[model samples]
Target chain A: MAEIIGGYFTSHVPAIGGAIQRGDQQTPYWKPFFDGFPRVHEWLAKTQPDVAVVFSNDHGLNFFLDKMPTFAVGAAAEYQNEDEGWGLPLYKPFKGHPELSWHVIEQLVADEFDPVTCQEMLVDHAISIPMELAYPSVAEWPVRLVPIGINTVQHPLPSAKRCLALGRSVHKALASWPGAERVVVIGTGGLSHQLDGERAGFMNPEYDRFCLDHLASDPDALTRQSIHEMVRLAGTQGVEVLNWIAARGALGPAAREIHRNYHLPISNTAAATVLLEPACGVWALRRRSPRP
Target chain B: MPTPPRPGARPEPIPGTTLFDGDAARKGYHLNAMCYSFNRKENREAFLADEEAYCRRFHLTAEQRRAVAKRDVLGMIAAGGNIYYLAKLAGIFGLNVQDVGAMQTGRTVEAFRQFLLDQAKGA
Candidate 1:
């Protein structure tokens, strides 16, 4: 039976994508931010998980108010990026693992998550920016993807508790899959910053550090936050931390933190990344030696 | 003008500001749909070509049209425009999210940026 091996979380900021597009990585302003990702690249090179389950929120690319699902699973063979009003030059198509997607959807529904499945989805910067940040391959991305678009734009977003439960459901689904392939679940958004109203440009490094310090040992502490508290403390878009809760839940309570990085003022947002490994000795450990 | 409550539901304001609930969505439907059209290059060009004509074509309300005309980010929000869609319109004027943010907060762009830097350094 398949089991979730690991999890990763990071921010998906368009400015980072913009910096890369303009070849500004070596520039003084962006060098430190760019410097942080090589460690992630090294992780990807070592573990090389076959599939990545990316949990991200769209800014405004694919689903408009016409029909926005709280949880959307893309089961397409190929996912393309839509021009999100202004032309973001780095838009590119990502290959999707439809077989794994369909299976995950089946298991999620069985577990009562009821995700809306899309055969055709135009991913926006939310998905592309992170893909580029982690993989950065000139050719196709190194890992096959299963894009799970979470709703953070619209009100009535899934609560942090619900998001955590949803992540647990996804982990159960992956563990039940018949394939022996290694899979990595990723949550992409937020380390506390807001982008709207008079309270815009809000950043709380203390809040961010508190959350990060507890992510591995006490994720439930983060889950206890109400949206009102989240808004007051982290800003509106800062609610995207629900994605991180969900990602952490997928790895179960035994997940061990392997890496972490945090930075601020990444285009009016505090950005963070954490890598985790499951402690059951089931996935990564089993790979090292045959299970006795 | 206060909108009448819907048949079975009433819209509640988000604690801090106006919520982008169903009522706001309805009130700003045309305004937002018009903004969404800016995703295309030609639509952006057409809007730049004759702003009034474009606003009229979208049947934007006087308040919304005036807000758009003056590039008042906060006014547009007050007129029920969601920021995501409003961002498309902001883009046509070469204003980034941070610029629109500064306008909403009544700060100059440089001041707002400095404020961000300060906040990062703050307690």
Candidate 2:
């Protein structure tokens, strides 16, 4: 069976792409944000995951309001990134794990979580920027990809509970897949920053830290708040933390924090990255126990 | 301590924020559709060549056209624009997030950048 290694949560601001394009990682304005990733790099080096299942929200690159899926999974042979009209350099296509994707799709349906399965998909900065941050300057990515998109753009979004359920279902699917691949689950976007309305520059470090702490120690506590409350506390766009919550859910009931970094104002957003390792024995034991 | 919110009650309005609910989606569909076209380089170039013509192709509302013409970020939002799509339109004019932030907040670009930096002190 495929082994689920852990979960990585990070922000996916498009400006990070431009900062990389202009070689600004060492500059003071960007150094703090860039500093968060080296430890992530070290962890990736140690774990050596063969596949990455990414949870991120689309920012008008792949799906628009025409037909938005609450949850979508990519089963394409290759996922491409294109110009989002933001002038970030296009990244090379990422190879996909179709067999695993189909397995996940099948499991999701069986688990009663219907997700749109796309044989062709275009990933925007949400996926591309994080991939660049993870495997910088790679001509070809090292790991096969699985892109899962959660709708955060429009209102009437799937509830926080629903997103968590989606992640748990994904965890179940990965555990049952008949493969030897080592998998790392990645959730991208938000620590809190709003970029629309008069609240264009909103950032709540208090809420961000609370979320980071709870995400690692008590993710269910984070979900107790309603979507409206989340938007209010985190900000309009900051609600992308739903992706992070879903990613954490994939780690199962218990996870140990490997490393975490949080910084303010990465292009009008609070930026953060966290590495979580599932507590293998505890999780396995809990799974074996009967439901309450 | 604040009182706990009633379940299913309408959330308190967030000041200076607008939720992109279904109403906004319906109102801004054409405008957002036009901005979405900017994802293609040719569409961006065409919009740049004749802003009026491009806006017409999408059948944007008069208010949306005015907002686009004035480069009013806040006005666009009021006209039902979602920031994600409006960002692409902003890109056509070489406006980064900071620029748009400054524009919406009525601050100079440098001031807005400083405000963002100031957020760290509280963190």
Question: DockQ winner among the candidates?
Answer: 2
The residue-level lDDT of candidate 2 at A107 comes to: 86
| Candidate 2 lDDT tens digits, A1-292 | 7878889989999889889989999999899999989998988899999999999999898898999999999999999988887666788799999999999899889989989999999998888888899888878988999999999999878888889889988888888887999999999999799998878889999999888888867888888888889999999999999999999888777888988888888999999989999875675776656669
Which pairs of residues have clashing backbones in candidate 1? none
Looking at model 2, residue A89 earns an lDDT score of 72
Write candidate 1's Cα lDDT for A54-75 as tens digits.
8888777788777879999999
Q: Candidate 2: what lDDT?
A: 0.90
TM-scores of the candidates are: 0.91, 0.95
Specify the CAPRI tier of model 2: medium
Top candidate when judged by lDDT against the true structure? 2
